[model samples]
Target: MPLSRTVRCICIEISKKRFNPKSLEKLEIIPASQSCQHIEIIATMKKTGEKRCLNPESKAVENLLKAVSKERSKRSP
Candidate 1:
């Protein structure tokens, strides 16, 4: 299934980060609440202890920042 506009936007924002752009393809946006519009964006690094939680709002940007920081840490030996 094709991704929603909101998901696409979030993916685009995530792709802008320094981490592997292909990782965005693995991103999953799941609805957190059936009643409300709250959603969760999840991204997991392969074989690495990296996971991120983000909302579609401003928190998404913050989460992406954290993801980048984590990516940097993983890259650093």
Candidate 2:
């Protein structure tokens, strides 16, 4: 099979001062040496076996949920 890449949501936080465009390469090795004090990348995924509660009233969120349900319902029925 051809290689496929899965898209995962990632959130990155870099400190205010060191985020300047020029210093990105220089700051790679050393976190402290760079003007930015801390950088954090978090992948926010629901924990296993946990139910994801959705507010049906939300237009955008509910639309996504409806799309998923519709796809499954189509396959089954």
Candidate 3:
């Protein structure tokens, strides 16, 4: 009998580029953990409700994060 292996990371394929901010519904940031050593960024689309994994190291992702932060700050009282 062989031992069953379990998948660690939730993301199967990661997008090297960024998606349109207007089309994005939500963003989930998973920090580096024992299972996955790298930070994971998951985006949910507004229209399709599809989820995509984003490369945390990409410059586009950095800009997206900044934009989200800015928007959030403006919304805060």
Candidate 4:
């Protein structure tokens, strides 16, 4: 709706009677993560007090973290 000339106050409502939410929902664009989904991993780590950081490759730190977690579990009281 385009109005030419001057106007006082123009209120356009598109929720209840005018526009559909489904059509508008289809127009939204979002980015997705590649490889493993990071958000889930982050949330899990937050609960368990574990943090994951990016390393140069999956060789050094990845193996290091797994070994540390395994060693930590092996430690006795």
Best candidate, lDDT:
3
**What's the CA error at residue 71 for candidate 1, in Å?**
27
Q: What does candidate 2's lDDT look like per residue over 2-73, in tens digits?
A: 632322212232222222222222111222223334332211123333222222233434444476699999
Candidate 3 per-residue C-alpha lDDT over 1-77 given as tens digits, one digit per residue, 9 for 90 to 100: 66323256778788765566778787799887888767788888899999889877666567777997999999999
Ranking of candidates on TM-score, top first: 3, 1, 2, 4
What are the per-residue Cα lDDT tens digits for candidate 4 across 8-71? Answer: 2122211222222222211211122453222121111223443233222324334445666899
Local distance difference test, candidate 1? 0.54
How does residue 50 of candidate 4 score in lDDT?
A: 30
- Tens-place lDDT per residue, model 1, 1-77, is 88564553323333323455345434566654543345556666565646655344434445666787999999999
How large is the C-alpha RMSD of every model relative to the true structure? 12.6, 19.8, 3.7, 21.1
Q: Which runs in model 3 stand beyond 4 Å of their true positions?
A: 1-6, 16-18, 58-60, 68-77
Worst 10 residues of 2 by lDDT: 22-31
| lDDT score at residue 76, model 3, on the 0-100 scale | 100
Give the higher-lDDT candidate: 2 or 4.
2
Best candidate, TM-score: 3
* lDDT score at residue 22, model 4, on the 0-100 scale: 22
